[model samples]
Target: MSEKKFTKIDCKELKLGMRFSAPVFFDDGENMFLGEEKAVKNYHINAIQRWKIDYLLTYGHLVTDGKTAAPDSIYMLEDLEEVEEA
Candidate 1:
């Protein structure tokens, strides 16, 4: 069996089809999701932004192919900063 892994990531990294390993919560500790491996949606992304949630816990694997894989290693903000400095 493939071992499951989780990671905390900036909400900005969230994309449609990414699955959550745990229920996302408000910074105030309110439960925001109660489903297993919930797939991300646009409204969910909007809510994250509207609520100003900076980070969330999600499955480390980007694809759900029943195999272990590393989370996306690229950081969008860091890349943006590098571009700005150029």
Candidate 2:
């Protein structure tokens, strides 16, 4: 059997204007939310926070402007700083 692992996205990383690289599912892991078609807005974050949802499930990463942020992209502080400088 193949395993379909899901990535968890903390609500904290969600910000206004972040467009997902792919669709994201709700915590239920069934219902879909952020489709790549649209960028995130204030109300989306508001609703997530109001519902006390700390995280979301997805198979992809977040895209902002022209940058794609993978969940696994977390690395050393120096690397992050280097990215910021670029």
Candidate lDDT values, in order: 0.59, 0.74
Clashes of each: 0, 0
User: How does candidate 2 score on lDDT?
Assistant: 0.74
| Candidate 2 lDDT for residue 60 | 71
Q: What lDDT does candidate 1 reach at residue 49?
A: 88
Least well predicted 10-residue stretch by lDDT in candidate 1: 67-76
How many angstroms is residue 10 displaced in model 1 relative to the true structure, after the best TM-score fit? 1.1
RMSD vs true structure, all candidates: 13.7, 11.9
Clashes of 1: 0
lDDT of 1 by residue, 1-86 (tens): 99445456677887766665566544444455424455666677888888788876544344465543223333346567899999
Q: Clashing residue pairs in candidate 2, if any?
A: none
Minimum summed lDDT over a 10-residue window in model 2 is located at 67-76
Q: Residue 70 lDDT in model 2?
A: 34
